[model samples]
Target: MSAPSTVLVTGGAGFIGSHACAELLDHGYELIVVDDYSNSAPQVFARVQRVAGRFVGAVYELDIRDRQALSAVFDRHTVDAVVHFAGLKSVGASTRRPAEYYDTNVGGTTALLRTMHEHGVHQLVFSSSCSIYGEAGALPLDESVPARPTGPYASSTWTCEGILADVCRHRPEYTVVCLRCFNAVGAHPSGLLGENPRGTPDNLMPFLAQVAVGRRDRLQVFGDDYPTPDGTAVRDYIHVMDTVDAHRVALDHLADGPGMRVYNLGAGRGSSVFDVVRSFSRACGRPLPYEIAPRRPGDVATLVADASAVARDWGWRPSRGLDDMCEDAWRFQRLNPYGYEGSARRPGADRRSDGGPPIR
Candidate 1:
């Protein structure tokens, strides 16, 4: 198999996509980014620009659903592979808007694959999720675990895996790698980019950041009565940089023609709500304010990764620790106080661009 000389990153302006774009750039891969700005900002392009050290890639404000637009970008760029990160990913939002979730996550992937086929682009690296293993009745989850997606968000990811499988089976020339990512926390070391959840964050790290930034009142410790060492739910919180590192390895797997593979990208460790809060406190040198509330509906007791597969297959491992995750998240939150609401910070506040607040 030949190396992927050029690449296309879908949803490249959003949180994960943006970081992946920077990683790809550092590796000297020619890049083309596609995003609709539905949940990000145009300023992200500038951020990626800084990460790249030059304006070498193109950014198209196009949605994946628009096949013509996607095809046009492919026609304009000589793309050798695709890293698909374009999809709706909120669990609660997915329940409220199931059809939209299916359309964007599942339908958009179908469209992207068709466009890739028409454009003669065969290699792909998909961003899957551990949510597919809804209630992992066990401690560590491996790639062979049965998927039981409890919500539309998880269902959508599983559906895409099935789509890729069918696409690969039908086209012998096509190659694909699906990465099942655990909870991705933390920010880039440069602090130039990070997880930018638009609305009130649903994840733990963002919520902690909000408390640290004084945007929210206090952290709500959900379900303190769970059957665990801490009596609260524990999760495998892998750093975003580590997740990006796995993407690098997955891309290499495809570039090196290792055939189709699925790997769980994680730290192989667990951090409870209290553990995260303590880490943040240590990182910022301030105790995070919090309250213990009933476990939110559908909360899992314990969910961590059996990261042995990826480590064995690609020789990859997470380098960042929990404290590192806290520090980076704090940096991003400290840099952007308002959480990209696009509202002015305050009377006579400084604004970066006339572009306005971030879109959710």
Candidate 2:
């Protein structure tokens, strides 16, 4: 499999997925994207087109679990590979709605795998999470550590990876790369594309951005009495661009052989919640208001990545820092305070997509 030319990107309307769509298009890969817009918006492809200066091959608004719709996408497009990003990702929501998470994450993955098998597409890049690691272990977590998934979200990701591994084992032609991503933050840097999650955001940076834009009054710092220097839970926040780059690189690496591989995709550094708040404040040109609160249950002290393996193997490592991430995120928020629905409409696009070939 010499670098795949056509890729089907699930969840292409969401934050990281949308950025990845633009990146893949920039690299001259045709994309067939699908997203239900549950947590995302449809107007993102306009910004994606603005960024890439090229339209997507096709865009389908449907659930990945729909074998007919998924197969229809494969049937219509010459999909050489698949980039799986469609699923419920909120850790808190996953716990509250474990059944929904399993049904969407686990069930959707199975549906996707079966559809791919039907189409004879054996190369896949799965979007997994470092949350599956559960807690900090040996300072910076590595791939060698045994998975100890805690919540439903992490457990679902762990299960998906297991299923992918089984697929590779049973089917010799399968080549899969499961990227256990850390906190993926930042915007497109163009100020045109960024995260705009529906309802209240479940992630820290987006919530902080919302507050900075006056959509919310103040942020609630989870804890300020942790063992770390900042006395707050720490996480490895990798830029969305770097994370997308790793996906493209991983897709190329699959050309090496037919086997299942796992890599920790992160910045190999940790930043506390306070650190992000302070940096976000700098980006917004003001100190964002905040109040310390009790530590949320199941929160960890540190969740940095030992990303040396990916660096050594694919020559991939995050290039953007916290300041860069915050600056871009703030730019997107500042440009569109009310998110996608309320943001200024692009020149040739309204609330809907940018006129790609529809699924129907």
Candidate 3:
């Protein structure tokens, strides 16, 4: 039999990336995980191995922007495809450091794509965000919706999409699927791996989980004066597992032919901030304390998904609900209050600080 297809997963030790690694392994794909652990803990790989019940083919603590290093990985391993998830993903942080966002998100993607072209590995599934669709012109934002990204993070993502589209236009051999994901919440059902943001959590679910577990004093509700019924922002919160599954399906689609496509991955539903708080309260067995604050800059009133395109094309649908998201996330938080650090024997240990030189 031919060898199992080896998929190189950038940021493989990260939140969604780790889950994707497990799912890929379960589906019988060989994995080469590359992570710098800049915003992730090293122990996540161990947890991922536990979940997958097997050893990953290789693990490189390298940044994707390191073209020489990334090329080395391509040379050493026969990477059939890449699930590109290596980039900074924080709206507030991106706003603070626009240059970093552009350099890492756009520049890193350029480096990876260049190396892929050199190695003749042409299939890619990119981790894009719904943030690319700024204030949507219509509800249930679909793939056709024009992207008017607001902040640096969204702009970088849009730029990366453009880069991929251009590559596909010229190189018909490159198969690229940009999965524009909605708010990715929840942990794996095993509770072994989950969202573990560094410093303070940026997203809703992790922040709420921290509040429920008393990591923070209380939750800070961003705003409560929007036009929605609850007057808070509304979002299509998709379970992280569902989001990872979309990657699998997209990779499968690539086998058919070389082309560039974009699909919104969401639950096709919206829930207000208050709804999430209420749901988490039920999950935590008590109401979580929060104080409303001024609206965050670049905040939108409502952002849901019209994921019919992905569903119709790939036969993918979100099976988990809001409650399922809350319960699993809470379980992860409760199990490890300090995220991976809480249980990690060597909390900050890394094999190498700099990614080192590319392997010969």
Candidate 1 residues lying further than 4 Å off, grouped into runs, are 256-259, 339-360
The TM-score values for the models, in the order shown, are: 0.92, 0.95, 0.95
Instruction: Give the TM-score (vs. native) of candidate 1.
Output: 0.92
Prediction 3 TM-score vs. true = 0.95
lDDT per residue (tens digit) for residues 175-226 in model 1: 8999999989898888788878777887889988989888899998988998
Pairwise lDDT winner, candidates 1 and 2:
2
Rank candidates, lDDT, best first: 2, 3, 1
- Error of model 3, residue 44, in angstroms: 0.7
lDDT of 2 at 255: 91
| Clashes within 3 Å, all models in order | 1, 0, 0
Clashing residue pairs, backbone N/CA/C < 3 A, model 2: none
Weakest lDDT window of 10 consecutive positions for candidate 3? 345-354
Worst 10 residues of 2 by lDDT: 343-352
The global C-alpha lDDT for each of the candidates, from Candidate 1 onward, is 0.82, 0.88, 0.87
Clashing pairs in 1: 342-357
RMSD vs true structure, all candidates: 4.7, 3.1, 2.8
